[model samples]
Target: MLPFVEYAAKGEHTASIIWLHGLGDSGEGFLPIAQELKLPDDLGVRFIFPHAPEQAVTINGGMVMRAWYDIKSLDLDNRADESGVKASAKAVEALIQAELDKGIAGERIILAGFSQGGVIALHLAPRLAFKVGGVMALSTYMCAPQKLVDEAVQPDLNIFMAHGSHDPVVSMSAGQLARDTLQHQGYQVSWQDYPMEHQVCYEELVAIREWLMATLS
Candidate 1:
């Protein structure tokens, strides 16, 4: 299992939300967001923030950082290395299985990510053997999109995608392309765009809270 920081549910622990952070960030980085969410106590939602292993990202002068996959180039089509994505997906699957072993149904678990982390969430959920509650992909794009049709297992996935209109790291168009790809593949995608940058804003959090309630209820 990946090393993770967990915010345990306050009540019966009926559901789980495994959230992934962006490149160069540790699990601790997003712990505050979970707390800020202030999800209702009755929901029993546990948040798991996992740390990506340290790696030398090629685009960043090969300097080692926490990355889900290597960004070999800025080109969206070739950014994420296939092997790295699969390896991280396998690791994330183990985390999901751990939740399952603890008696939480797969459908009660929501997979979410930001930026590079979103890349993993988007890539792994459809390929999973079982269905998850939903996927929250923020400011991210698809990886190996051309192969998604042949490799996908869950065709009825619930996907919520949000991107900043002014995002420079991951352009809004890149995010749109992802939404378009998923929609073309017949997956249900809810798209939202904010007038902000690469980071999340207060408005987005409010929307996320509402979505979480709807998804986990």
Candidate 2:
């Protein structure tokens, strides 16, 4: 199993959110965010944060880092490491299965990630055997979007995407392209933008909390 830290539900555990962090970041990176969110105790949501394995990131001059996949170039098309993505996707899929083993239905589970992690979440959605509750892709762009053309629209598979307008790391243009591409493919996406760089802001968290409440509750 991919190493993870869990925040047990404050109330009864009825739902689960398996979240992944961005490249060079471990599951510990976003653990604080769960405490900050206003997900009501009565909602009974268990949050799981999984750490990505350390690997050599090509774009980082091959320095080993905690990443979902290796980034080849700044260009969107050739950037993502597809093999690494599939490996992480399989790991994430195992996480969903762990929740299932614990009796939580697939529709009550959400897959979320940041940046490179978000790319994995989006990639895993169409490949899932069961439809999940929702997907939250923050500051990330879709990899290999053409592969989603023949993807079926799951009943409640909503996508919540947020990006920074001034993000120098992953350009906002990439985010917009993902939104347009997913919309054209008939995915329900709630796209939001903030006036910041490649990081999350307080306001963005509020929007995320609201979107989560609406989509998962």
Candidate 3:
């Protein structure tokens, strides 16, 4: 199983949110955000933040770091290495399975991520053999989007996508393209954008809290 940091539910663990962090960051990086969410205690939400395996990222001078995949180039089409992404997806799937093994129904689990982490969330959710509650993708874009139509098993996924208008890492247009593509594929996508950079903001957190409540309720 992937090593993860977790926040146990305030009450009984009835539902779970598996959140993945961005490149060079570990599961602990997003722990504060999960706490900041302040989701209601009665909702029984257990938050799991999984650490990505260490690898040499080509775009970073082949420096080894915790990354979902190697970013070969800044260009949208060539950013994510296919084999690395597939391996990470499999690792993430095992995390989901661990949650399932603990008796959380597939529909009560949410997959969320930011930047590189969001790419994995988007890539894995639709292709899973079982359905998840929803996807929360922030400041990220899709990988191999052209293959989604042929690979997707869940056509009606509830996707909440948000990006920064001034994001330099993952261009806002890339996020928009992802939203458009998923919408075209008939997924229920909730889109939002902020006038910030490549990070989350107060307003986005509020919206995320609301979405989480509605999704898990």
- Give per-model TM-scores: 0.98, 0.96, 0.99
lDDT of 1 by residue, 108-155 (tens): 999999998899999999999999999999999989888998999997
Ranked candidates, highest TM-score first: 3, 1, 2
Weakest ten-residue segment in model 3 by summed lDDT: 150-159
Output the better candidate (2/3) by lDDT.
Answer: 3
Which residue pairs collide in model 1, if any?
A: none
CA lDDT scores, all candidates in order:
0.94, 0.89, 0.94
Question: What lDDT score goes with residue 11 in model 1?
Answer: 90
Compute the lDDT of residue 73 as modeled in candidate 2: 91
Q: Measured by TM-score, how close is model 2 to the native structure?
A: 0.96
Q: For model 2, what is the C-alpha lDDT against the true structure? A: 0.89
Minimal lDDT window, size 10, model 2? 148-157
Candidate 2 regions off by >4 Å? 151-156
